[model samples]
Target: MTRSRTAGGGGPVALTPSERAERGKAARSSVRRSEQARFEPGPDRPDPVAILLEQEAARVPELVPIRRGRMLESPFRFYRGAAAVMAHDLGTAPHTGLEVQLCGDAHLLNFGLFASPERSLVFDVNDFDETHPGPFEWDVKRLAASLAAAGRDNGFDAAERTAVVLDAVSAYRLRMQGFSGMRVLDVWYARDDSADLRAMAAQGGGAMLARADKVFAKARSRDHLRAFSKLTHRVGGRLRIAPDPPLVVPLTELLDGGGPTDLDTGLRRLVDTYAQSLAPELRALVQRFRVVDMARKVVGVGSVGTRCWIFLLLGRDDSDPLLLQAKEAGPSVLAPYTAPSAYANQGQRVVAGQRLMQAAGDIFLGWERLTGLDGRERDFYVRQLLDWKGSATTEGMAPQGMRLLARVCGRSLARAHARSGDPIAIASYLGSADTFDRAIADFAESYADQNERDFAALADAARTGRVTTAEG
Candidate 1:
């Protein structure tokens, strides 16, 4: 695709596929693709403990204990919340300098099933709290390492973990190669439909496929109504959020002379602010619903200490409810190493990045800036709370099941990268050889070792009372 260069008064020539591929191959002179295949903690390695403490300094004090509690469960759990630590390490490692909008914390658990705008279930990256443009290899390394850590936690043999990571990398290589040859629009529109996945599972016919069936079934049941029924109750002839300490604290409880009247006024203001971020049509649809209650909800492992609120809105009647989550957005973990975001608000940066990377996104997705009751201003992105969301559990997955999931995750990541980066360059760099794949597997094993040491140090800190942790 050639384009006119108005400033130069001439048309800029577009490079052929062969030229693009050659350009990628030439990049090997600066940093060999195989060079990134290993992991080592050189002399200047940053202290992982110090990194964790620095991140903790900015989070809610009360929720820190809960975050610590969840992270302390296992090495894999600790890895999930240590994206900053990994970012620091990636900065010290070899890099290809091919930038793509990365899922900065692209761990195994981060990829999951969620509903598309069309209400069809799809598989994609469901989290974007730490997204930024960075070296493409960074995401691949993070994912491979996560597989190893999770495998170790699940008592899978080292051989099993190695095989899984290799399969994932190979899948990514092949998919990118395929994407490189496709029309740009075709790559942009590709998505993993849940119906297609189910059909594949049915054809495969194994214990692994059976497990996938269960995950899909669970996702189908987790819609807005399910969340509303489970989290709210009738109080004095009106629906109010149930008070669950720490995990689910109603906003009204945070104020003096707390009552429904005070809560409604404050929450309505927040709703108005959030509505301004949405498109005019979405705003109109949102305005039709009346805000009933809001609650501080403790969410994911990495996000526990961050402020997250769940809003319940009544539409047509008491039975008609819509749930939305307004999640706080901070600077991405990758920000310290990569270029800063152009968007002034971090929430807007998140929303923009998610839209650019995903094939589809939540219709209600938007960003807002609001001053909290504490007089602190925070950026938050809002979306539907539960839209057929489900994630695969590693605990009971068979070896075959893990491998199949690995391939799906790999393909999803490739598609995401192709949408935002040069598919030809990435595919050319990977080539048809298994060199990159083997190298990533090697790095995954080595990094998994490093993660265990970091996890052990954190566990010791908790046991010695250096850090406080509350049991879940």
Candidate 2:
């Protein structure tokens, strides 16, 4: 693979196997720094519960109506409310030296199915914008909390919900133990496809096989061309994006009617950065497409305020359209506890982490800094916005299916951690699944309570006119 030079004349240096191993060791050493407490004294602010309420007040406008409606309910209201609290706990949590590319926000909802390079559906952690090197416990805690909350929403009793949370953690711990027994390359080469996963689930008493089958079917039905066709329509002779207010908007609204808009310039710069980020062959493959239009598209609850743009690119013909997403980068919630990244650019952090975690990534993955209309410089990484993606719906899943889904998420997370972390050390720390699972279950239940209090606080703020709620 041809190595592309950085924007200035200094090109990236290629590393030999030994050199790469040395770098990995150095990275691991940096992560070891996180095991010790480095809690900085800052201004005393709201408690974790209060902080969560404030965040919810800010996030309320961005949530879809369906999610918003759920928030109106008690426990569901609490889960949305307690995100910041969970973040706070994670920020101050105890750590082990073993570190991988951590998914800073490892909520249950974040796991999903996506197409690999081989066109097979695989289940894995789907979001990495908040990824950083930190204590693995933080991710485990967050995932557990999300599962507990999700279980509540699914109408499971408290004990049953606790069991589900424990099972998820146990799966992660056991999988990490298994990974510790494998050769480094063997662990790295491991990939899970739908068929294998379904088989595994089937072996586990047909736990999640049916739901997995449904989600896999839905995801495999979606591909690049199908996605583009669904999102684009012909307006006269020109291809234009169909607008869905608050969620999706046309590019014209985001740009001035000049030769090229601010978005266009930002996108071009981002593409150039992305080209440098890719391995040589992938970069060359991406060069064939010419960017035509871009649109600002809103996605996910936590990511609503952040700028996310979908670029429409043209290949040899109009029929060959590719959609890429460039989402703004911000400080990782884990930054307060984790070692500071060597890379200054948050987008670069995201792009680097995604490449390290995924077997094969989108060719267009890149990052650039853009000055918004308000003169604030925002960093962003670009990738295929939604190419053959789908996830198991927690709401509709049966208890057994949910348990299996949690296990799949846990195992996949462990695999990712194993690839980038010292599996033997991590496995040792995790020891038995029982203790870790119980710990996570405890944390999840406590966090869910915190979320409720926070949600109420947000509701109170809205009721008292501290924040405004958008009407559907």
Candidate 3:
């Protein structure tokens, strides 16, 4: 495969299968590169925190209610704060050659439970819209920092917070080591079902078992039928979305701004592209359904300004409905660090990365280019956005619950990395859990401080009217 370089002053390069194999082999051989890079904090370069804030400030006018709603939520506030710091640190950090497909924002909150293709609930890294190949340490650092931040939110003392983060890092290290010992097929087959997780928690002989059971219950409660029941309402034999401010609103209202009638036309065209992306069996299954209600919905903090749509499709019966979400795609946060995607469309990058990371993704996953109301061409990917998805509550989890959650995240992350990484070499580099745990613990504390500084800056900007908060 030949790809044109969009960054740097480089020309097109041909990457043959053999050359690709060689690159993977080289990456495997150099897996311990992260260990070689001393983990000292780097001198600040251009503050990515400030840069991100400036970007957000530009979008604030367009993202009034949704962004304000997210900022008002404490956990969401902390997440935004942490993201600013991570982006800052990453902008300044020295290179560790060990790179893999990263969940650019791999915070503890991002890991969750979703249904696998087999209709069994499995714990996994649930979001990958920002996926890109980059230094593996970035993901580890972000995850560790999130643990500390979460602990702080739960009112844990510094010592307790350290212990929680250390335990999580230890689990991540040990799981990676375990994967190194597995055969390729075994690693590929490896999955963490609710039963397996509960059993592991029981074996840990702590307060983890009860917490694991609670997590299992939450995961099980998020099936397709349950999700549909919660989001849809029946009105005279028709299925319709219950309108909610910011999060959900009718399509007619969204198109009423006199922005463009083509918005609806674009949506219809995108749905056809989505249908074509599905596997034959799934496509056939979906073809039986008729589109009933559609809405424009806003979701997530960082993704507030992007275009997102939800469609309610009803089968022969009103009770049989499926909900799908289509989200716009832009350049990845990791784009600066890794090679630019060969595909011109960012949505294609997202779809490809999801397929690579998930064993069985929504068959309807796909992308298309559409001209928006502003006459800007945008890329979008469509999927069964929330069929059976749920996450452990991080707000007030007991210390033991945090530990169990950490292990689940660790195991899931290992499985994700193992899919595209050289697990054997990665395990070898990790060695024992001790050093890895300590390193991440140190990074987490330092990064948390960075987050605080950035949060204060944001507050200052809001006060000074450089960036207007909803309160302003």
Candidate 4:
């Protein structure tokens, strides 16, 4: 299975499987698995609140409070919105230099079930806003720490949380071990569809399998039509998006009595340019539908204040509806720590990284750069607004339930990293022992403690009126 292929940089160079394995062994010597357990905040660590404040400078003024409020809800919620803070902390940490496209904010909630190009429910990393190439362990640590924080939110004691974190790290170690020995294309094509998930769940017990089935059924039910019905209504016999205010605001309300077409014209232009980024088939498929409606949409915790929008199109009458979301793509949160993306447009950076890491991506996935309604140029990546999307509930999850979910998440992350990284090297470094898993589990507990202190900083800022916050 040894073949010459370039790993995102330089020319193709031949390296035998054994050579790759030796590279992994060398990395282990440089950074021992037991050393992965070390995590302690330095005295010079940046102020978490100040980092949030700096981050909000590029976001919409009115929406910044909403972002703060969401982060203020809980430590886990804060963790969700505090990717920048974590990025800063990670800067001071050590890494193996085994690079992969990181799910820059690879928290537990970021992993979910979505419809693949083949229309099957594939479980994989669902967020890419902060994705970039960096040390593979960064993403793993992100996921591991998230489990610890979420466990606290769900009332799990320290021991239970550590055990759950171990389940994820162990699954990742074992899965990478398996991938290291597989053929390259075999590793590239590997994916965990519904059947794979069900099989894995079956071994956990009937209760776990039933829970997985429930999540699968829920994902299967959420398609474009379902999203259209929930988010649209007839206004003067013309379909338009229903305003949920703050969270979902129609573009008309933001126009300030300006000409109706001014902003709509800008959005249409965005769509036109976005179409160019798609394949000829998708471009033709998209041209068949007229851009009917578009609105400002605040999505996800960390992405709340970004320039996110939802566009509605109809073809072959109202029954045939397509909803696409154009989300603003900024620099990767890991950009400062690793290296700047080679891409000029942030949207393209996201698209390229996503295509490299995900088993499958949305068919309509594309990117465009446009002068927005504010007369500012912005980068955006477009995809379906909603298509068979669902996630496992972390709140109130039992210890074993979390452990089962962790196994799925850990393996899922490994599969993603394997696509873009040297799996043989990584597997060799991890070896066949639980040493790496236990070390990471220890790091997770320590990081979770640091996260709580950061959460308290934000809380204090809100109480002192140092940062404005609003109800979501």
Candidate 5:
């Protein structure tokens, strides 16, 4: 397949619009869109359980069982935590090799409502732990497969599941085509408005509309104040984080000889390093707050075992609390297959990819490298713990609502790709027909079947004591 941009040999020569379009069309000769539409397990697929265990080697030993238990919940849950498994399989799949910064784990649940820097709710990809540059189809496949898994989890019949997957692929294809004809700045500026999503949900009638309204309302309340009320309490006249065993515990409680002094000192150093990563203006804003209490917060299914810490800071007083999350960042699951990142730190890779793909990002987003209390150095990206963030649970969505969510996610993915990759080339590759769309639907159903088997394998592991699990 032809590369989207000129290959670097000496100096680069900019290709004309026609040259770019022609190159995109030529890609179809080597990588036919129809060929990529199916999924079949290769004969030499890696053992899913083995791959998962390898990942656990670098994670918190105590939390590894928790991550496993979360994955054991259902097929959909398994899919969410098994990004490395899918990356291994995607390597064997046919592709055009059109690269884009992927939300490597672009599952439906990863798309959510969060306030922009302007305080307006915008729907976009929220997680970047697995962000990397790779074949654009990998992200699409992940999203489509997620719909199928989630559809089954929600008890939708096969027909309803098929419809949802198809709708999402069609939205992605059509949106890419629209982006192809737009100005570069226009494509960069494209964003999913929460109001527009609400209007779309309204078409599903009163019940669906009410659900959407409730979700949005809940998202609006996920600010620092809301977090403070639930996570903090007055301890000897000082506001300190409340203990929530297993999931939310003060850092001092987890470490050997760990106490307030040690916790505060380490956190203060982390915040100082993180502030230097930010833009000078933002660094100035951060300097106003002093670190108060930091805690180990077990987050999502995929992130439960990682080193995730939430640092509490007060801007002026206890009334002006700010919470930020310092999440460990590692090599992208796709990194093994794709080229190595140009950035030195994996956290910087995540930050750079997020900046390139999102229309806008958290004002507090930054990265740092530090040695933990265990004395092992790791990279981490930091951002606001809750900036009016809201996400819809798969358990509650109706088929119609799932379709709407799929469309928005598809459109958001397109927007993200258009910003960093060649939209014209991708759109030209997708074409105006249903060939690519139908093919993804086929792949999604097939992969969904594979996912069930993988899920069953993990369940067996848990039952046989091959893997440890705890109540999620």
Candidate 6:
């Protein structure tokens, strides 16, 4: 690939518009668009269960089962948690040289509604834990495959599933072409508006439009106040996040022999280090609050085993609260397949990638490196725990609603890539025809079939006592 280190590289020489477009057209010679449809997992593929066990070595011992069990929940769930396996498989796959700031795990459910710094709701890619630079098609393939898996999970027939995948790929191709002609700043400022999303849903039919409305309404009510009500309770006149065992445990509870006083002090120090990465104004805003409680929070299928903590702070009184998540950052799943990150800190890698790809990001978005209670240094990226955050419920979605969401997510991914990658070249590569679109649909269906077999393998492993799963 010409550009490989987190998508924003152009060397010392800036290519002219014509040259950029030419560069894209030339990529077709390296790997034809139709060839992208191929997904032949060779006989030497790594054992999927072995990959999961290796990842578990660094995770909390007791929580490993929860992560494994969550992955075994369904074929779709298995796909969500198996990014490392896909990375290994894609590492061996052919690709175009074009690179972009990738949302390394760009599943459909990862796209969501969240309030921007302007406090206006917008739709965009919300997960960046595995964000890295790689072939633009890697992200596209992941999204398409997720759609195929969801379609299968929802029991849609093959014809309907292909149609859903096509809608998404077409939206991405057409949007990239539109982006290719825009001014640099215009491309950077492109965002997904709720009104535009509503209109797209309307094209899907009345039921899809109604579902869109429901999602928007639910997103609006998911601010910090809602988090406080749902996650906290009054404990001896102090608001504290309620404990839920392996799922959610207060910091003082998790750390052996550490009282709240000592725990708060350490958490306060971590917050101070985290604030230094933010802009001065935001740092000052955060300094106004005192840390009240910190909790170990297990979140998401792929992210369950990571060291994720949520900090509760009150601005003025118990009535004013802000929850911020400090999620441990590690090497991107794409790292082995692509170039190593230019940034030394994994947290900084995530923060930088998110800033480059999103139209707008959380005001509190930043990164830090500090020694954990285990006495080993680790990187963490921090952001508001909830700011009108909402993800699509992939299960039980109607085919029409799924198709509409596919379009929405495709357009969102194209917008993200256009900001950090060469839009002109990518648009040229995709071209005006639907050849690449159909090819990706083929690849998606094929990969989804592979995913079912992998899921079955994991189930077989569980039955044979090779892996332990969480109990109900």
Extract clashing residue pairs from model 5.
Answer: none
Comparing 3 with 4 on lDDT, the higher-scoring candidate is 4
Give the TM-score of each candidate: 0.95, 0.83, 0.86, 0.97, 0.96, 0.96
Cα-lDDT of candidate 4: 0.90
lDDT of 3 by residue, 1-472 (tens): 2232233556676554344334534653543343422344556455543566554553425565356445545543646534544554574556445556777788877787777777887777767778877766677777888887777778888888888877777777778778766666777788787778878789767567776677667777777678688777867766778777556877767666454367667776677666766678877887887777778777776677667888888787877777888888887767765678766888888887777666556666777778773367888888886756778777767787787777777667777777776555455556653766676787777666666665666566566766655421
Q: How would you order the candidates by TM-score, starting with the best?
A: 4, 5, 6, 1, 3, 2
Candidate with better TM-score, 1 vs 4: 4
Question: Where does candidate 1 have its weakest 10-residue lDDT segment?
Answer: 2-11
**Residue 234 C-alpha lDDT in model 2:** 81
**Lowest-sum lDDT 10-residue window in model 6:** 1-10
lDDT of each: 0.86, 0.69, 0.68, 0.90, 0.87, 0.89
What are the per-residue Cα lDDT tens digits for candidate 5 across 21-140? 776777788678887766778778888999899988999989999999999889999999999999989966667867889999999999999889998999999888899998899999
Q: In candidate 1, what are the lDDT values of residues 358-463, reduced to their tens digit?
A: 9989999998887653457778889999989998888766677787778888988999999998889888888899999998999999999999999999999888
Q: Candidate 1: which pairs clash?
A: none
Model 4 residue 435 distance off true place after TM-score fit, in angstroms = 1.0
Flag regions of model 6 displaced more than 4 Å: 1-11, 256-265
Best by TM-score: 4
| lDDT of candidate 2 over 5-53, digit per residue (tens) | 2435576754343443344345434433223223232355356434534
- How many pairs in model 1 have backbone atoms within 3 A of each other, for residues 3 or more apart or on separate chains, i.e. clashes? 0
Clashing pairs in 4: none
How big is the positional error of residue 247 in model 5, measured in Å on the Cα after superposition?
A: 0.3
